[model samples]
Target: MTEDFVNGAAVQALLDRASGLDAEGGDGRLKAIVRELAEAVMRTIVRHDVSESEFWAAIQYFQEGAAEFGLIVPGVGLEHFMDLLMDARDAEAGRTGGTPRTIEGPLYVAGAPLVEGDVNLSDDPDDTGTLYMSGVIRGPGGEPVEGAILHVWHANSQGWYSHFDPTGEQTPFNNRRRIRIGSDGRYSFHSKMPNGYSVPPGGATDRLMRALGRHGNRPAHVHFFVEAPGYRTLTTQINFGDDPFAADDFAFATREGLLPVPNRQGDAATIVFDFELQKAGASTEEGFSLRARAAV
Candidate 1:
């Protein structure tokens, strides 16, 4: 039987100091959270009987894999947990049902050119099949949500996104755009059919997933950010129903009403999906979180 020292006085004092519980200069709420987190970590260490070498190795892993943390977060389902938490909170507040929110993967770039009505997202000359996607944005009451901006982005057939592709072959903003909704709240775009992609082979995220006996792969999907006045900003994406990984997305982003089957016709495909928005209650819900993103 392993002796538990996590709750002992000496350990408690160490946790308190580590979390700055005795300091009055920092935020009270933050300090409280830190103390709780530190205690929880201590409990885990004691429960697992983690060796000092193992602990240091884990720290070194994080230090070496810091660049892949964004992917790791989703791959390990932390991002999805956040979505579930938000959903539960909304349900508790009686703010139920429009469209389910999902994890916004860390590949979004800022400052896409805004266009009115319809637009073309695939400006590059690629051999991939053409895709025609159209959608309407509506409120909970089924009324059109005018003045909305629909931001869309996706990877190309080679499973490479602009601004992040290592081949240096993609133009800036290759498959990204922002379409402003007209009075009818309709938005549409034409682009190359995106392909499903796996995490970079041999990278930190891929290595971690392999060690966990899991595969880091996402289905062919289109990302969206729909925002309108008086409505909560929606960050979501739709996976292609035909993709093999649609039901097994590593990012856990697939949701009901978000998987649209593509209608195939020769070298072209068509997808029609509608989106519904919930009314915003707080000002913070009116937009996306301010995070560092690629800009050109």
Candidate 2:
């Protein structure tokens, strides 16, 4: 039998005992993390007088949130938070100066078809005006990095990704392709500008956003995964400057210097954005996603 706890400190003590929070006694890392979280929750409960029903309701909300991990992580700005943490680490390690890093929203699929030079990113014959994006990939010192591969993908005119949308299963990887830079370090592609995407309706993410009085709409953008030998891999996206939702991205992944202004050329448009890569360390693998290290 245990004494009934009425005070905050007593409540914390009870949690410690129940969760094996004593550092010298509890050995597992996961156990320690859970104990710390439990202690914090206990304090919050005491401070806010949270009722048992409210606590359980919050748990259920998280359970629902888990079903749509992709939408929630970006909608709630966790993906952007991860990028901020990486920027801080890079500053600390004196590893600065490269194209701004952005979040790779959980929609990337590996093994898109590879092509030499440029490949058409949009296959729909009914697509709107063509967008021709051309740029050079250079190293830290502005020298061309030959043979760099740029994996490019984006939503369709209807703001739906290829593999994820049921209607697109026939031509999965539509609007997705990889272009290898030539000796001139230049790569270009033709595609229709992708429309902005909103969180899927009737999902948990949409429900939460509605309850919070927020819109879950991202700006028009294109994703790129740039990789080359002896250079750090980059996963980022570029936002269209003229997009109405550019300043109000739900994912909060937009950054300065990454927005591109379009130049209309008669029937088509062009956007030029150069990418600079950082040299990799001796043991760093080619095309390593920095997010892997941020978790550690």
Candidate 3:
């Protein structure tokens, strides 16, 4: 049908029933959200006049690529949009000044070995190109933030993460560490340089990107979660400015302040960055979302 039919009383009644609008013993907020979502999808179907075969094919694609949905979320910009939404809210709340938060891709693992000071995260002999990164955590007023913990993880030279690598060559917790900031609020780590990577060739993300005339590639970067007591937890990452995909990240994670230029000498490189964190207004801001994360 058309937009008129999709918005008619008959469809509204069906949606209300489907979303359990009048049903008791269910979440009222969830029912309202589901009804709105159903209405939006129905409008989209009518707007595009999508064929039954096309709709079923799309559903099948999602079912087959369930494993890659995490990547697909960032690939299509939903993840980045979430960051932007939070940023807007923070601005509205008058929170300002700090390292800009960015998308936290679905690769973070919890419980890396904690170190008191500078540490080496790369232990795999197969990894190449030494990297030395140091940074300080400061409060919003530019004072040192002691007792901060920096959780860091990155891919290897071949763009394979430790636990998720399919080749089974990387050791557990390879290129991952939990560094405790010194009393001076400084933290440092050594690791092999990470390489940029593209979406799995011919996979769901790649297929969808190609269909939309886009490339699915992300620049070489390191992920981090910096947190301290009484301070808002910061989720951010640094992309290598020299990488070709640094500015063209398919995940839209390339922020102006996040691209740090690496100073190289021979095969070794160094980067120095600093972070500022606002005071937490509530307990909820002191930790990250309790999303399911990998361990070990």
Candidate 4:
């Protein structure tokens, strides 16, 4: 609207301020891409027959999208980006070709019962299943990671995880548990295993997917996240055998070694699962369990 300045050139200046980004000694990757796109926006506005207010409205919409940034995997794509970086590291290091990494969905909560060698996978989980998931956790060198802890959880019957189901009576951290491997390198737990369902279909993730005409369903699977003092954090899932999309998870979570075999034939009545982790940082004389860290 000013005499000397036109409609589009003024907006281009807002993005030009990012030109010195690489000189600041940081990753110039994202900033440079943003600047190029900003120039394109200005050119588009100058060429189109669109009104001035319409161009301003487009900017307003992008502002809204940025303001709505979130932690959900389906939102910013950071979760997937982090996974790719981690997998690359794993490949370079040639550690244990371990389990498949999966999304930690917004539902994973900290703190669960610190039990010994076995868990009962019932709502009132008290030894309901017959099979116990027993195994030894070993470092990348095949040495036992004695005293390390493994956290485990799965959905209750009807495929509902706690804290996410308004209709269910389960508590906030419903089928979750934290167990340390014994000095002998053995660990075990009992729980009715889980089956996966759709990602929350009405949330922002699903809304965006529906707008793209994508299905919001995640295939049947089990979630696992494990950590110990000297090992990298592992987040993964074990998918059931029947899903056609097992190789093509919408979450991109399904990985090799995470898909458990059909032992009980998909029955929640029993699951005898076991896993070993690759070593991470320096092994310290200092003891570490999640509970010990929390007590500090």
- Model 1 Cα RMSD, 1 decimal: 1.3
Among all windows of ten consecutive residues in candidate 1, which has the lowest summed lDDT? 1-10
- Candidate that would win on lDDT: 3
Q: If ranked by lDDT, best first, what sequence of candidates would result?
A: 3, 1, 2, 4
For residue 114, give model 1's deviation from the true position in Å: 1.0
Off by over 4 Å in 2: 1-29, 265-267, 290-296
lDDT of 4 by residue, 1-296 (tens): 33223335555566666554435665587778877876666556656756879878756655654422332354445666767787787688674465556566555556776777655544454222333456667666667776677777777655677765667577666677777777776777666655556655566556656766776666666666667676766666666655666765666666666665545633333344556675665554122223211110
Span of 10 residues, lowest total lDDT, candidate 3: 122-131
lDDT value, candidate 1, whole model: 0.90
**How much is the lDDT of residue 134 in candidate 2?**
91
TM-score of each: 0.96, 0.86, 0.98, 0.68
- Top TM-score model: 3
Model 1, 174: alpha-carbon shift in Å? 0.5
lDDT of each: 0.90, 0.81, 0.91, 0.60
Model 2 CA RMSD to the hidden true structure, in angstroms: 4.4
lDDT of 1 by residue, 1-296 (tens): 24367777898898788888877698888988989987887778878889999999889988999988889999999999999999999989998878778878988988988887569998788888999999789999999998899999999998999989999999889999988899898888999889999999998899899999999999999999999999999999999999999999998999888899999999898999999999999889998888677788
Candidate 3 lDDT at 205 equals 94
Which order, best to worst by TM-score? 3, 1, 2, 4
List ranges where model 1 is wrong by over 4 Å. Answer: 1-3
Regions of model 4 farther than 4 Å from truth: 1-12, 16-72, 75-78, 92-96, 125-132, 265-272, 282-296
Name the lDDT value of residue 162 in candidate 3: 94
Model 2 C-alpha lDDT versus the unseen true structure: 0.81
List, residue by residue over 1-296, the lDDT tens digit for candidate 2: 12224345767677667677655655677676877787677667767778899999989988977857877988888889989998999999899999998988877777788888667887665356788899999999999998799988888778887777757542667788888889788888988767888888888888888888998888889999899988888879999888888988888878987889778777577899999988887546475554421110
The TM-score measured for candidate 3 stands at 0.98
